[model samples]
Target: MMNNFSLLLLSLVTVTGVSATWPSDWGFGGWGFGAWAGRLSPSQERQDEVHDVEILKAVVTSMAEWERSRRDTTRVKRADGSVCYSNVGCFMGSAPFSYLGVLPAPPAEVGTSFHFFSPREPHRARSLSFEEIVVPAADALQDAVVVGPEFVPLQQDQPQQQSVRGRRDNAASDDRSTTTTSSDVAKSTTPSSTISSSSSTEQVVPSSDGSISLTASSLDGSGLLEAALNLGFNASLPTKVIVHGFGSKCSLIWVHEMKSALMAVEDCNVICVDWEPGASLPNYVKAAANTRLVGKQVALLLRKLRTQYGLDPRNVHLIGFSLGAHVAGFAGAETPGLSRITGLDPAGPLFEAQEAEARLDASDAGFVDVIHSNGANLIMGGLGSRQPMGDVDFYPNGGAEQKGCSNLLLGAVSDISFLWSSSEDDLRSLCNHRRAYKFFTDSVSPRCPFPAFPCESYEQFLEGECFNCGSQRQCGNMGYYSDRSPARGPLYLITRDNEPFCAHQFFLRVENTPSPAEPLATHGRFEVILASKELNESFVLTDKDDEVMETGDSLYRLVVAHPLMEELTSAQLVYTAYSGWISSGLSSWTVDKISVTDAFGKSMSFCKKGMILSSGVPLLVPLFPGDCNPPRAPGGLDIAMGPSISINNELPSNASGEELSASNVNRTASPAPERPTENRNKTGIDINISLHLVTTAPTSV
Candidate 1:
């Protein structure tokens, strides 16, 4: 008579097509599935126990080492050995329960360089030694739901396992012919892992408590339709499918944060795609390949939703991060009329330089927007693509080095601060890749608009040459509400280093010389003050430490809040030069022209286009001199503008540059001493300044 144990082994071997017998000296050779039969010899059992114990110890030790190195205050080691540190989940267990749960290993042809989770059947009897059990590689496991104290992918190798996985595979291939025939592009189903019994796709519907529910196990078209209706998914509302990146689960903090923000704005159906079965860690290449299969499954789900309900394909939006970004692109390619797709710093390592069909591109949807926050070298751990992959690509803060990620001192403080809520990966790092999604989440319902200006490059943006938005170079907003429908090409913007990443933007053009003569070089800081009917504001502008400017015509942009003004009044600017670094090595500054603009789309020309104003004694020159009056342009020290000014020889040249000194240049003396006889050889320098308005009112407000 066939007993339950024998029957179970036979059933496993039959379903997975894996033989029941494997070498007992598995550790000495390599890992493989084997039959569990009669009791083992005492020596053999002892060896198995020792090997299992050592593996468990190694896993646990690695987890501890990682946690200690991170030193994140939020880290907590659960009783079950799982560690939730740095907001990234880490599952650890003894002998059978591995970090990511049991998953079928990749094919033997791919080499045995991969490490896998403990077992797919974690709920099996613990008394039965792992050596006495049949365990398949991760690529062979199937099923999508198995709720328990700790969550892991479902087990589908059993005889009673449903055919959902098989149907999902077929749906991926079948829907392609019906959906993508018009483009004449062959629809290739995403390559799935051969080890698993089925695919690694799961469907999530937003629940009433602002949480999401795993409603569907497989990608079966019919099953998806049933689950969609049961979950109260409204097909009338715009559908947003949020896909996660490699080694990430659907319940990640950023994923939930995005879901909450999206649902709060409107009554829409937010379907978060959960494919953790293929998104496991320690094997990034496997996860990369799984994106395609998972993406096809998503297309299948969308197709079912459209056919079963009166859903419009044009209203669907796909947003993906890292590898998930490419997944979204694949989905867009399969389904053709997706309204929009947003790539949050799409992964660059393997996807870069790949063909259009192999990665995200503008053709993937009606309007595609991408945010590149970490586009540095691969050797530096940068994971974002540098190539423009969307209709509107934003390179905030130059799109390579991010703000707030550095601050060696702050990082040390945060390591001790129990309230460390930000991801540890972002702390004390300049180019953290995850900021793409963080910026997007805040922009969904931000207090201030994240305005992006169309610029030639990040370098030009810093120089403030690309602010004019009308005919020359049109600008646009970035993030969820960006006007990508009409916006084209890569856009550049700047952001603050802390929370509330938005910053006020202004573009200024400085005319440094009036003639073609050799331009003067000067180093100093300047401040702009505005007087209006309602408010008074001041902004300071300075070159970066390494940004020395040679006297010449130049355009620059400033990101700072300006005083609110319905109508133009008057503006004034004050420039103080560093004692030893001024043009001609003199203690004075020369100005030729000036222009001004505010964040509220207001523009005002300070002086006549080519007018020259010099200061022997540093004094404020009213830009809109005619507009300065009683209630219109309020209080400011009136200083006369002239082509030249005289300075006193008695006053020392080492005056503090922090403020303009009234005594050094003799403000009361109309004409004092002439330039030093030796200094007469140097010519005066001219500076032109223009401010271009950049920020726009938030769409929601």
Candidate 2:
């Protein structure tokens, strides 16, 4: 049965005669069933087979109709007085196809001149010869089919001219027969430049002339509305417009998840913008160029919503991911007083170096918040921009390579098995690039507040230096509530690797105090395990680099605890000495105390004076609270709190000599030290621990 299904897919590809190269990173070994046959159950396999067949049939019919439209001889005059055979011909003469080839001269009666503003040079208008534009018959098959969760075309041995009458007839009889050709649909929706379809199940159609489609769906799963003044739209509610990036459509799983999340959080109008025809794969440069036109369409829609329906522009929030981010920016630029725009890892390739007017910037809206999840250089496999493009930028875990995306093999496997997974987000590939929307969706109705601190750099933030959000730098929420934050500039925070990435953060400081007999500077690592009734998690304060810890040195780390621990019951300390040839004997170190500060400004100190820790041993210590208040001397003078001392022989500056008696000396309670035990549990720490630590004092006071 699996072999027959694979053969059927291959035959369909052969019959369609649509041959094109797919992206190398798509991880397509071959059109064989071996990759997924064993992973999916019988029922899932049957459903996938049926779905694949339907998609292939639709692709064949759509391609056939597009070809017919491309070959049509009827000339239509555009509003700009340019004559073109069809909508596809008009698009062929546009700037996106500039690199294709020159067109032949036209007749004296026909106008062949086509003018379009170049994306690279927006200030200048260039005229191109479009007397008779001819797209290569073989290369004209540019549309990609959705196979499972990925957008890829079927592999074929060679391009062959074959009839698609059977597929077209089958598609016409199906319930999805309303799906029309790209050019046909573009003509029908040209007046408003928006397509109205069911947001729940909109078929992605190829578009030309950079035309945009809008699908307005409410929480009740109502069908698409024609305009903002339609009965389906409620002017009283806030509006959230979601735009997808290049090589993606509005009906994508992530787009659906985001729309659902936003609607679930509040009663709002969710408008999903679909520009797949202009933003399809194989021509990233063309898609980048089309963003400007799509942005204009979105801006026009917002204007109608404001003027016709009395919807305030301040209540409109545009959320765009990747290249779509810039689309929202363009719209925001046109529509003044637009409330906010949230860019999720805006595209980096063409627009990263472009001017602010051409890309997403803070000036585009009243407030712009950007989440940069994969902002590394393009040469390093990053697809998102690293530059700050908003009023408040968020760089979660440095915004480059995200957690749980380090293993290339794992990501590839996830992509291949996407169909079998229960949740599409869990098995999606390009983990870092796609994480921006996931984070934003999770933040809509979060389990806890996703607080991010305004810091100069993520490295400094990890050292517990930027714990306080003050007048200089205010704290910002990572997701839905970021616009309400007073924070300006780049904010940094750490999250878990998986879902519910938000974690309770705490600043932890451990002071190392050694005895006179022991070495002043010991070389080892310290691991702190915080245990609560809800969860037990461990975090390392130092790396395995044989770090030297002097007697007075302190280690600071940002502890991110998940499962929402209300109160920490106890903590376990594990010390491992660096095994060197000269120091092969049993090594030991003494710790004074551990201090923890929560996000709410509450501080707790756990003290056990002269607690000895040996190599390869774990010490389970109970949570013993210690008073951090300064003690008063016998003469009622305050004693300055300093490092813990074994003996206090000095007197207060204003105290008399007679008052310096032993009974009059200030004393503080110290918890009894616990002995190290030889337990070999070797439990691994949670994914929240970043493994980077700061040993020196923070530069900022």
Candidate 3:
């Protein structure tokens, strides 16, 4: 049975994505035998039975346009010995809404590709880290069978079942107490497995019209999140972490922007969670209590991520604007899984409350570094209220309000808020996913250049080059001011007045009928400033080169997640075998590192760490070698890499899906489900996975 499943899966690997002519049925809706035949049964009935009430329909809708295009495809050779194909079919949401990465088993030979970006794999930075989170195809990618944490009592189906944290801290107590065991408790509440009873093992049977089907439980109630069909269907791994907003006038700007940034950097899988608005608090006391509760929920999600996905327990980052700041902070403080949180002007209203818990600070949560624009965040112990996972936190100009609502969904435009005020369309505070990303990953936008240096200090920092304002053509620095500095201090950016003055210039909202025919005036101002952590204790842990940065130093270091350098390009830095360097005095450090600061500078030590340098630019992501990054599954057969603006451009809408379809468009492989008669009283859990794979198929065309 396993072999059958593996063979069925192997048929889909168009490793040689040759662009030769294909068959007309390629990527079109088709079927297989056995469970496959049952798949087509009551297609409409399944639709009617599938109960989906997720209010975040826009998320689904956002993905729908792309989903509808997925289709099955097949390869065919012509009479002339060449090959060609065709696309057809439609795509529908598979089963299991949450984190599909672990579901609907695929053959071990295949896995889907997720796009992403990271401090370990930035787009154009100089320094890079070894951060690639990949779950093995099926076998290793087992869905977390969550029961419950010891702290909270889950409302299980069992009327009287209970779970409590045991007082015993000893290993013997942990093993014998049975208090931590969720299996018995969960079984008391719900049935063992949600899968159907008849399925022994998935066996793909061919059907007429050259299509396949499978028998599995799925999201729509029709099937489980089935792993694969021959349809050259495609999947994306969301590499970016998005803080999705849940309130009206509460835009998820940052989520979208971060998505774009991650896409620009590499193929990544995106995890979308709610950024709910705080319901109105009648009083300070109530508000404070509510804030605590909100924080708790955030904490729960963090743990879920850790248990559900192999999200680096340390690398999870949060970027929240407006009210999300509170939520991010609450989650960061409350959850053990979370490491970083970026509060873009966390609302000041909540801080007004008399409640102590409501007053968020670095210490409140485990996050080490803190950042704030205005004095909105409370400062305690010289640490910031706006804690981030790393030791370094940036406070761009505009105080706490600097780009307050950076949750701007628009990609490049999201970067604008940091350098300038936003337009009316985004006036209600948007999320700046790009800048937020830069906070932890040093993923600065090309538009918003880093402050450049010319005094033999830092150069080629991209954008904001050091220039002699004294020289006519050189003084147009976007973030720099007319002032030049030779001191070891903040790097200032100067903005100039506009020519045909933007009628809607920030600080001035001009209406129509302006009679002024006068010369276009300049209205530039200092936008952002970069300073060494040495300037302030919050930014402390600043060290010079050859300082022999040890374990206690902030784990922070500059990195270029991705390199544009086509060939070998190594930064001139020496990293001790036991530790990664904080800075390389050599001018050669050029992998896109904005800077690397530690969360506990001189406080914590790493057991074993090594240096990772970008050896190549690796422009075409998902299929390239990066700073110790494993390659991503390539796009489906016959497709080359393209910067598809529309999701369909990257993935297959049901129609485009047909372009990559196969005989098993609906065929599925059912992992061995523990039988009620056999394992009704099972002991340890048995795990299996169906991995949908995209291989090294080449585009023959």
The TM-scores, one per candidate, come to: 0.53, 0.58, 0.30
- Give lDDT tens digits, candidate 1, residues 558-623: 654431233435445545555443333334444444555443234444322222323223233333
Across 103-174, the per-residue lDDT of candidate 3 in tens digits comes to: 111111111111222332222111100011111111111222222233222222212211111100111221
Q: Which prediction has the highest TM-score against the true structure?
A: 2
lDDT of each: 0.47, 0.53, 0.25
lDDT of 2 by residue, 1-701 (tens): 66754554343211011111112221111111111122234443233223322222232333344445545623643221111222111122222222212221122212212122211222112222221111122222233212121212222222211112211011121222323333222111111222122234443222353222232222102222232222245777788888888666543445545654565445677666666566654445556656655665576556545554677989999999998999898778766678999999998866676567668988888899999998875434466899999999999888887776652423232232332432432323356777788788766643445678877788888877787553444678887778767778898988767655666677777777643465577777888877666666788898764777778578878877763565765566777788786653238876766766655444555454455677767665544333243233455433333322213635324323332233322233322112112131122222232232334221100
For model 2, give the 10-residue run with minimal summed lDDT.
161-170
Runs with alpha carbons beyond 4 Å of true place in candidate 3:
1-239, 244-254, 275-299, 352-360, 363-371, 374-390, 398-443, 446-701
Q: Which order, best to worst by TM-score? A: 2, 1, 3
> Can you give the lDDT of residue 562 in candidate 3?
13
Candidate with more favorable, higher TM-score: 2 or 3: 2
TM-score quality measure for candidate 3: 0.30
